[model samples]
Target: MRNLFCPKCSERIFFEQGRCARCSQRLAFDPLLLVTRRLEEVKPCSNRDLIGCNWSADEKSRYCCSCALTRTIPNLGSTKNRLLWSRVEEAKRRLVYDLCRLKLPLKSEANQLSFDILSDDPEEGPIMTGHSAGLITLNLAEADDLERETRRVAFREPYRTLLGHFRHEVGHFCWDLLVAETQLRGPFRLIFGNESQSYENALKAYHERTDRSYDRAAFISEYASSHPWEDWAETFAHFLHIVSVLDSVAGLPLSLESRALETLRDPYLESDFSALLASWTPLAYSLNELNRSLGLGDAYPFQLSSVAIGKLHFIHMAIQNGCGISACGWRAAPVPVG
Candidate 1:
């Protein structure tokens, strides 16, 4: 995601901040523009006189941009719900911000979209990660690292994280875009398989068989090995994961020079995977080495497959088309990974 700063003071602001410490300015985030503007200084909200949200206090009206997208927030009476819901909002805002920056479409799940949210029986549930009727539901519990890690270990996945959840679910959303478009549907079918197949049975098959030969050439994760749509989601998530993480690493102190090299030529948009990977090689190496110094595992846990690269190519194309960025042309031919 692109970096965010407070417009008034240029203070680095967190996505969730309602006020800026550096400038003492109330702020509101514009979800459409993925930007935070000073409320007191610019576009002061008319509502500020009545409701007194910080944005209103600053004089900008119409719900600081991010809050406008909220169809419903859990009742704020419960402190626990308020805190957990805030975490959800922060992550969701970042996700939506990137979507906006990429000029991607996001309709409310209520607006006839394929996405939906379901409440597990309040008494008994995994407490996170639910899928129904094309809408993936997230339990607020996942925002807490301890709970997420516990579930991750219990699920026995090599990796699991909040951003992973977002990217994966978005893959399902984008599939709707491709399948509905006449130009892309046939190619999707040829690669990802008949998505109309029984999802439940496919999942059961994945869970029951331990010895099934894994198809690395076509998948980014083991769960992806279970189904074509999953393959797409896993790969899509990784594309976001890598790009965002690489940008974050670039912002760190250790590798400013390498960061310059990778982004200097627009590796994120370039169709040439070899050139992109060359830029990434040194960064990934330094990342792993840095992790080792701290007694941690590799910073990135997965390898890119030829199949995954093909999916990434399609994703990159979709993003470019979505954003109207024509700096680099896309390739229709699938890229093969050795």
Candidate 2:
């Protein structure tokens, strides 16, 4: 994200800014926000008023790029479900923007990445959040703060968030599209372990295990230790989180405070993974301290070990191999202004 400006008044604004604060001019939803709004129709998604999605849609389509990928959303018959759908859509839009920044292919040869944001009803049984093939399912209860926090504590997770879930689940889908049956598969197997292992057995054993104090030095999280696929997904999510935060940090005037961030590059476009680590370490510490001051737990609690760094580097290379400068088959990101 960059410092957005109001075109009308030249006042500072934000990507989600509906109206310029200074001028009160209405700003249209930008599907391709970093560069410019491709406002062919100047029309908002049909969901704009219903679910509060503000992205623009082409005249032929009722949905925008983000909303078009959603196969299903929570039932809006109830007030609570409507609120949950709004929150889910908000996070999904952010995930789509991040994928665009990474220059990854949103649609594969046959499998187009999509989402099912559904709710668990008392009579309908519970819905588990996970990924399959190209579809990512998210439990709508994840948007409820109290319920999410309770699950986070119950699972003993270092951190849990709606966006975090999207990143992690999408990581699984990326593995199928980017890693499976590719040259990178061999290297991925070596690093993340062989995915040929029975994932069902791995998951079942993981849940049946009594010990919860296993060493997590090689994994991003304990759940990552369950299976090779999970290890890859967890590491992948962490990499995306790192890049997203670094991108936001680059947008700020942090160079004035830290020499480490003086020559910050576009994190999404940066080739060197170590460069991201260098800027991230200090920022993470500062953020953790800030959270501590407010009697909160560490904002970033995951400790990056050498093994974890290697996994992150693998993800970095995978991204570069797909969308490196001067050779990206896909479009390069335009000058990010938001």
Candidate 3:
């Protein structure tokens, strides 16, 4: 989420901008360089004419890296589905941007990370959003603000959004990528618990329990307590959340003399986990207060306890180590059913 500017006119731009507003230069995001470049001939992505993707394409593949990962999309015959699909792609591209910035290994086409954006059309039955192995499926309905809000209220979740869903499910995929077979597995088990435990039974017990006491000190969310794997995924998701947000607000003049902010670097490349947290704590607190003053809900509703911090450290270490492995060498685990 680094600030981008149009090279033509120097006007501020965004990750998804297709044209520079001031100079009318065509724009495309260069995933490799992690910057928006002005395109002279507008060598737009194949999806550009179809779904409005503004990214540059790979000369060999003719699809942008992010769009290439989409295995399936909802029915485009309906105008509603087309709009929802575009929104989903926008969020997915942002997720890919963060992943690339971290220099993590991405699966190739032989065993690529794929997405299936499905709709909740009655004929298609209910579409449950979840990740399996390297493939992540999302419900297109979640793109609708009202529908997403309704589900958030029903689930009693403090916060939920399309980007959060992408980050969380990708966490599951990364666990399989970076932790499942590595030497880190032992340490991961020690911190998150035995992932070998029955996920189905744990989820059943979680839903049946009457006492919904969430010890924020121990768990990031009540849903995270469903199983050891879930705990790992939730912690992984939060690690991304914290670092990404921190990166966005790192050097802002918040009118406070803070050492952490003064020496802030890119959180993705930050080796010291504690220093990142030090900066995040005060920033999150101030954001929550700002939200309250505006009569809005808390911007950051969760608290990171010592125990939770330990789990995040494990994720940070895993990612730091895993990024060195060759993308093709990593094996994909079988997708768990049920």
Candidate 4:
């Protein structure tokens, strides 16, 4: 979420901007450069004309890097589905932007990362939004603000959004790519639990439990306690949340007189885990207070305990070492479950 500017006029632009307001020039995002550039007719994506996608495309592949990852989209023939699909695509683009910034492995012919955006049609049965292998499936019905809010309340979740879903599901995909076979699995089990435990039984137990007592300081959410895989996914999603939000805040010239903010580094490339937590803890507290002042709920409701901090550190190390590598060694024995 770095501040973007129009190359032609130096006017500030947004990530989703299709044109520069000051220069009256068409704009497109260059994923390789991670910047907005003046749109060139010869390089425009095929989707540019149809869906207002302002991204450059390769000569052989008419789809942009982000759009190319989409394996299935909702029915475009229906007006409602078209709008929902566009919103879903926007969230996906942001997710991809962050992933690329972190230098994570993206989709390729040999190792593909794809998505399926489907609507919850009655005839299609219930659409369960989740990720498997490298393919992430999303329920397009989440695009409707009211519907999402309703489900959020029903689930008793403090936060839920299309972007959050993408982050969480991508977390599952990354676990497969980076952690499942790696030596990190031992440490992962030490912190999260035995991932080999029956996932279905864990989920059923979670739902059937009458006692709602949860160690909020340890787990990001109640759903995270359902299984070790879920715990990893939830923790991974929060890691993305912390880094992305911190990156955005770093771009802003805040008048706060804090040394942590003064020495803020790029969270995506940050090597020191403690420094990130030191800066983020205070910043997140202030943000929550600001939200309260504005009559909104806490911006970040979860608190990181010692155990949670250890888990976050594990994620940091995993991303730093696992990127672009096929294997980081594997551990046959599981550690004591948490």
Worst 10 residues of 1 by lDDT: 110-119
Model 1, total clashes: 10
Alpha carbon deviation, residue 333, candidate 3 (Å): 65
Clashing pairs in 1: 39-58, 40-58, 43-60, 44-59, 44-60, 45-59, 45-60, 45-61, 115-135, 116-135
lDDT, residue 146, model 1: 82
Task: Tell me which of candidates 1 and 3 scores higher on lDDT.
Answer: 3
TM-score of each: 0.61, 0.73, 0.72, 0.73
Lowest-scoring 10 consecutive residues by lDDT in candidate 4? 288-297
TM-score, candidate 3, is 0.72
Candidate 4 local lDDT, 218-257, one digit each (tens): 8989989889899889888878777777766655434445
lDDT of 3 by residue, 80-164 (tens): 8888898889888878876887787667333468899998778868999998878999999989888999998988898777877
Cα displacement (angstroms), candidate 3, residue 320, comes to 55
lDDT of 3: 0.78
Clash-forming residue pairs, model 4: none
Candidate 2: where is the Cα deviation over 4 Å? 33-41, 254-338
Ranking by lDDT: 4, 3, 2, 1
Task: State in Å the error of residue 308, model 4.
Answer: 48
Candidate 2 least-lDDT 10 residues: 288-297
Stretches of model 1 off by over 4 angstroms after superposition: 41-77, 108-134, 211-213, 246-338
